[model samples]
Target: MTLRVLGIDFGTTYSSMATLDPVSGRATVLRNAEGEEKTPSLVYFGADGTLVGTPAQNIMLEDEEEAAWVFMAPKRYLGDGDFVRALPDGRVVTAVDAVAAILTKLREDAEALHFGGPVGPVVLTCPASFGPSARDALREAAARAGLGDVRLVEEPVAAGHAGLRDQGQRLGNVVLVYDLGGGTFDAAVLRRVEDGYRVVVAPRGLDRCGGEDFDRSVYRWFDGAAREEHGRSFDASDGSFNSPVLRACRMAKEALSSKPKVTLRGVLAGQRHKQDLDQATLEGLIDERIAATVRLSKDLADAADRRGHAIEHVLLIGGSSRIPLVTRQIVEALTEPRGLPEPLRLGATDFAVAMGAVYALVALDDMAPSAGSPWRVRAPGTVFRDVDAPWCPEMVVLPRGRFQMGSPEDEPGRSNDEGPRHWVEIGYDLAIGTCAVSFAEWDAYAPRGSERYHPFDHGWGRDDRPVINVSYEDVQHYLDWVNDRLGLTGREDRYRLPSEAEWEYACRGGRETPFWWGGSITRRQANYSGDYTNAVKWLGEYFKRTVAVRNFVPNPFGLYQTHGNVLEWCEDTWHKDYIGVLTDGSALVKKSSPIRILRGGSWNDDSRNLRSASRNWFPSATRLSWIGFRVARTLIS
Candidate 1:
């Protein structure tokens, strides 16, 4: 009798499941009842008290408070004091319960799709930063979903396993894994030895950062402008944010990514307020946040360096990695004086984790097979051991090779960021995270006594949605804590910011095109403003704010939300002219000035800012919602 294993990548913004068919030897992504491989991590309780997915996400738009259903993210508070309380009815639900529902849905899908027997043992991926309590919560959630045995795996490790398996590549030395998600960021350095992979350092992460903040930043900026123009306060306290008008404004913000402009129209206290939001205004509003993410990335590198370990290459992962600003910031930060070789190129962002999960499952099975298994597994001599020092995830090794880097020039609607049109050579290999970071990962490295340590945000929503309102300094502190715990010197050169060239090269996934999908940016292609396209009177009339990550399609490289989620940070000093610089793809930081480059466009940005080559700058000291970052490592042969 063959046993079936299910792997779950329970993401903050989206959730997905995969399984290895014992008979077919093929991995398959399970589609929900809606016929989609991924499901929104949302839950809504109806007046009849029923939970829903896309439908629930819709209802929350109109009756946000009373919708009794939350959309996007709600998984950050698994073992904390946080609980989702339904107002009026006062029905309280734990984060575990909410996540259990989604898990149960996945289990149902697995059972329905099963060709042999029921799904047996299960493996779930978590961020490397998850502490004991958070891991316990996941175990409990899995138990509640009726799984007999549950094994926890770090998301990056799973992604690494999958990536290596897919590419038939292996790592021979210590490598770093950098993971950025919709709500959190994490980093880890691991070494591959004769005994298998062992984490040489404790993973580090930030609690309150991700793509969601970008949306809110854009929304708040636009809300402030609307209030100023209409002479009416549109504060969340004043119910203006909750009003249909403000919601409409948010819708417009989401729409602008693909369209030239979007309009926002609504009544403010019986008065009409209508505004046309150009791409420039939207980019301007969230510029500060973009800078903050860049600063955070530098701080993370600096913190790692302080511990005496030099990161070999920087790994980039997460849906938000697609933004042009993200790539540019990374290039500026890590690239060298003239040019040597572009830092190692990882695959696309979105698929790294899922693919990693697949790889991990195969690897694990090969190492420890049940008795009487007939499969001819590779590396049968491999032994399995738990990552003892607080496992988060693993980074996959991306071998240097010649793969298609961009879409054909004849492809319609390609953006400049996609290309001046060229085929470039990536000569070196690098490691990348198998999946995006998670809330559990953030809590592991949270400052014990810092103000940012609180598990839940009373002013905002839930703890699991991703911690926000953190400064670049805070992110550095978290990285430092991880370094201290691991007894490793995090050298500046070893663990540093990724150059812009590295970021874009990874995001392109061997394809050059305006968007990751090889054409124009669409709502279905990514998480930006498509919902408002049909609702507003004009294309420009939608509102602004960040939505969830995983709300869009993955680029050819399997990365998600690269174009419009949150701007990411890169490790370069701000410089307008690149004429004399080295094109080898290393990062440069200015010692005198405390500013860094921010890459990627956010949910609130227009098409122009979303272009692959667009650049933005910010002070290193500042932190805002619309910005976050992924990480990379140098290849050590």
Candidate 2:
């Protein structure tokens, strides 16, 4: 039950499988019999039975004419129009059936990796250029593999999904995926957003080009050298492409990725020969193929601009993309002559699609909330409780939705900084601290008075009381310390300050009114000055100073003292207005400012200042008695 879904990157040459546990929020990649996450995307039918993965790939050394029944790179045949490959049993099977057999083997491999029972929801990735028919075929393949409800995602989107927090963020706003695989080449353009990404332009692929083509080119070059140097040539018969000679060529290609030269040796046309091919020779043989792909990628970039997209970085994925020439070509394409960030060569390129597909699955699920969605909502009567870790502050699961982030012009006693109401969309769920971080949590990281201001807790009751008089610099240090202690890293799940938009979004808790509860707020619901109340006819209690967090009722999002207690710091820097802000619920940190934005009213602030749309700013290093901070969980793992 913990395994809610599975993601598979079904590639032409290699495939990988991964599973995500919703409850535990962890993912595991399944390795094959070879003790590797990627398995050969091949299948073979022998006299005894059918074989897939390493067994099939290892057996390629045997005489293919004798083995007879073999299927390699069946992905090349998909959507080729009226294509059906014959099985060894005299019955014919379509490309979908062959691919399904390989996928079925993958699931069996996954089931052996400490997981049992039927695999849950499945997402399969395909080349972006795949049409409706190809996608339909892909779904049918998944069905045959026991994944009946499989969903299809684009390859580049999945690649970006796997690296959004790391390489994706560094790639700027617009990104591209330059995937060169065994059977094809694909170039796509996508726009990065907070939660995931969006396709600005559909992918374009070269139908007749890929790694296999390059392999053929290399094989031909070696064949010619053997003919001239030793008067021998490789067989050009029906089984020549799959012969050991070509296999040697493939090995050289792989080895040459890291080395400058490789020695290829094999029997060819009744003649045994060995040839040392250097990088220069390999480049010469395949330069045209790579050049064609480079041109196509450049065209895709230009086409993206026509659609209002400006590409910032090109990410190289797929096993073939590991070639030095491929990386060099893309780097030159994106940034040549002038100094700029080079193209990204991802270390996780082989598994990017599978991991990214899992991310997409979880992200898409966040958008569609079920009636009893266990992810965002707790029981009706459930209230605030202590988080298990003593070093961490208590947190509440914030709901998912959109709301007006800024205030309207007509709102009462509103600041100009809060006007120009803009609609903000929150696509994912988040966990925010119930209140400002307590002195107990802050001191655990750094003792009182260690900061430049030499601030102290004053022993104003340190246990659950908000830790005030701390600068933004001190707060970030605290975040890094606690995040390191929690073993949180990478993009998705880490402790950090909430963005101004996110703070407002969670503060509103889906309410359109000025306060989470309604259009009005009161001193009774929060800690603030007692002279006036936003709620009419409601007598509110006055709390002149900080109270222990969760001392009062929580808002709809199960958070406490969101209106006042202490003004909290946000991830975004100070901006004069909300004009041209990111519509997605992400912090606006593109331009670093000396002053950072702060939200919520402090103990000395008026009730009008407690409105959800209220905002203010001060020096990043300023330490004040009324300024504190809370943390937000990205939950992206």
Candidate 3:
């Protein structure tokens, strides 16, 4: 069986659980015995045994007389060793015992419903303010619940992982995490690194500020209204109405988050009180607390700025962050001041911490080869030859790293399309052809009249010259033939054209200069025409026609003729600019048209077109004497 791990968000008021699906590689929330994603963190001491989660919470609300037996928010008192409760039978329950009961209930339900037998590992999320004693108390609780050696992650950092992996945000971003839970509010600034996010500013929070405080404010509003209308002080603290009224107030607070108005109705001191609360009124009641949270966020951003890190995004998580006021105030306060974009609140905010813990767990365990840990089958620049092939293109492996995909504005041969230079990360094992596909290699697949296979070498000898007159549409048939020869016909580890981003990254060969060799190029470096030069000190002879694939010295990546061979075809559609392109080194495939991208200036072109970041495009069927391609193979599925 595959090793399955569980992520538990041990919240103060409610808790949630999640695990990664081994096949899909997605973190999914697990439903408890009540068929709900969230389980209440309340545990009750009953006559026969202990009751936990939704059942215990229900009893506490339905039967107000049993409130003394039910423990609430035991997470707040985790480090206080003197904190304990005595039952009517003279038995005492500590904070660790209550937390352990909740964890045991969640584990039992998850194992029976999701995991086939027992979960392999567990990672739990906690507040960043947790000290040594609190952390030790949580570990003890997990141990008592039969969980062996659980890893604890900070809630804000976990949410940052979810934003990057789950939400598909850019990998190298600086984000601010705003987490407002039921009993606490936290703000943290994190910078995305190659392996994981690093904390730029330590998390800061308020212990007594959260959704529970908002509930109390709403309850006070209703109490004040009741006193003004009836001319009497109506008290429900000691009556049967206490639990039901508090529950109504909490529900109203939650409802107003998405609704314009909500009607709160419950019996208070044997008199029914009905009130309609609008979002504006609730915002007014909680404005002070919300402002304080925003102040904390700004302070964290200021600290990051002092360290020369610009925050790119603001991610909102936790239940209380769903309020309209929270998003609006945060956006207004953080956007214009720092020139950052509006806050991002994608998907449901309730399960971000739990889901992020699972993502972090997967990364820490090295379960699969991802962007953080790419599979290294062989050494970089090592050439590999396929087995049993009459003639195969030698593929040289390239080291995975990040590079700028476009030219700078001050470059000698810059264009408008290359103005906004952006970063692209290539984190997979990619083996690219050491040279352009030669006629010798192509003839092995399409010798003569092999189903619409026509050789067009432009009068050049078909012995070792680079193949020309091939269109993007025609390259598919050649790929099919090569895959069949290598026995990779329908597998993910197959041969195909390189993506536009990957081509540029390989062409640069770890240099930011115009050419891979230096700041300028001459006839000695490439095969391009010397008629047009850009920042070159010497003008040398011009090669009027295509030469052999390996006629010149290889680039630093061990790839020859990358600068002035036939224009290589890329597997990307034409885009006007880099407006919304992904930075993950994948092709941006738009099916609206067949205008594909091409790279590397040919021997018939000027030297300006041979710059590393220069771009060109043509229709899929446009074949010319200066057009060809190089193949790339994925080392792993």
Candidate 4:
């Protein structure tokens, strides 16, 4: 009966729901009332009552005239306020009302089958083509469905999240998503940053082209042949969707994927018609549509290339992407120049977007358990080491609190990007390394025997000294190694670099002064050069070489060398200022950038650079002799 989060993919033709599996750290799709992974996004209104899912689909096929009451593809008109219809009971239905009905069914099914009550946070997925109005409509629909404050994610971006979670690869790769659903086609390019992927190129897709169009073509071919045999033209019923002819045509299209030919039998315009459609003929009918998708994918590839990122993998998602012809076209069009591998075809194409939405939910809303649950809560200054890897850096638990991030304009040596100071709330307890990661810890992961990059160490000796000459990218490999050793590889709770906000908050240690000790810093307090002084009281001393991380006195938070020693890499992309940065203490990693934030100060920097609010940045791949990093652990309660 524990509260759980849900991710719902609201597709034009079908809908799916998923949640994070705490045990495996993977997304698990939830089955609907009929025990199916996917539910048809159809609603039928009749004199008896309202019907959804399979029953509604059955009713639609039973009577084509019911197309007036049966609603399908409501997703296509999400933001169209003018789109309104009336039901048999004399009730007016708008696009929002129809979408709400579908979402309500999904939520109820999940609660009944899994949670036994209302779930926790919900993440709803929509097409990338959705504008601000469409996004607002989706939120309004969820609200009407009784779902509280839900998060919104683009369908293709959610699919990208799922792809990365399933693969469990380290970050820094470019990927493309080709999504062909029942009523639309979307192609998006993404770059895998930190814990998620960012859209490299805005998504491009056709609003009115998808599997339904193919179904219409099959209906036309059969209707034309039937008219010729009967020697007469008959009355025309509803043009498409909910019509028995279109339903039969859709069934034939699916069967043709695996079968050499499929028989389509139906009464078109009151005339009984039956025909066998071969795969080749069906391919010819939808060739132009598939060609359109291929052209869109090529454009994305070229855009990524122009941005200096080569798409490493292409993921095919949504129902229509299952067609063999779609894959053949994508492979031929995208395999040149770099010999890109064949586009990946997921087995659960219908559920990829939903599952990916779950992964994104975990990334954005993940939190540790409360104190005294499965995870133990310890007081501040409590230092511990992982039992599995005793050589891991020692971590000290830090208390949670709110603090003003960034500096005031009046502060000495304040940078323009540091102003516009904002309040950041560190809501959960965290454990940060007592000092910067040492050379000994780095060597334990990539030893002399391994082929990993070995820093020069500036001939300053290795062991207990802080690790230097390391790039931001190199630090990620070490963290991955540590997580693997502790068996927390892809879980919500793992070792990672502290976010910039967390770094500044920890450095302050509940002090409002420029330095944690006071407004002035002395040579005896930290490991920075004293030749230049922010305040003249303590000046005229300098250490040209790096010192051991723990050689200095600990701050009020029991953290050592937080003010100096080595510049620590923080987990955030560099921005001009804190104008629109995250206020929740989480990393601001919306997009991938070559530059990343760096905190603290190095051995050769003046005292001004060692202040708690001082900030700096460097390219992620740039290795500097003064740059190193500390680790932080998410304490799951």
Task: Find the candidate with the highest lDDT and give its number.
Answer: 3
Error of 2 at 351 (Å): 1.0
Q: At residue 176, give the lDDT of candidate 1.
A: 50
**Can you give the TM-score per candidate against the true fold?**
0.52, 0.56, 0.56, 0.58
C-alpha local distance difference test of each model: 0.54, 0.73, 0.80, 0.79
TM-score of 4: 0.58
Give the Å error, residue 89, model 1.
Answer: 2.0
lDDT score at residue 318, model 3, on the 0-100 scale: 90
State the lDDT of candidate 4 residue by residue for 1-637, as single tens digits: 1348798999888899998777877789999999988899888867777778888988766765676787888898887878887775688888898899999999999999987889777878877666445766888999999888477766777887777666655322888889998888877777766645556555666776788778888777877787789864323443343376777889899987789998888764565668889989999989999998898789878856755568888888888888899988988888654687777867778888999887765653222233333323333444445431335666767877899998888887787988798999988878888789989888877777689877878788999898898998999988888887665688666889999999998899999788899887777777776545565644435677788887776777767789888999999988888887889989987565888999998887888899889989999998988899999987753
Q: Is candidate 1 or candidate 4 better by TM-score?
A: 4
**Model 2 misplaced regions, further than 4 Å:** 1-3, 21-27, 87-89, 228-233, 236-239, 337-339, 364-637
| Better candidate number, 2 or 4, judged by lDDT | 4
Write one digit per residue (lDDT tens) for candidate 2, span 304-340: 6654567877788777888888878877765563244
Best-to-worst TM-score order: 4, 3, 2, 1
TM-score of 3: 0.56
Clashing pairs in 4: 369-637
Tens-place lDDT per residue, model 1, 468-582, is 3344455456556543443223643132345666666656555555555554555444433443311222333332554444444444343445666556677776765444444
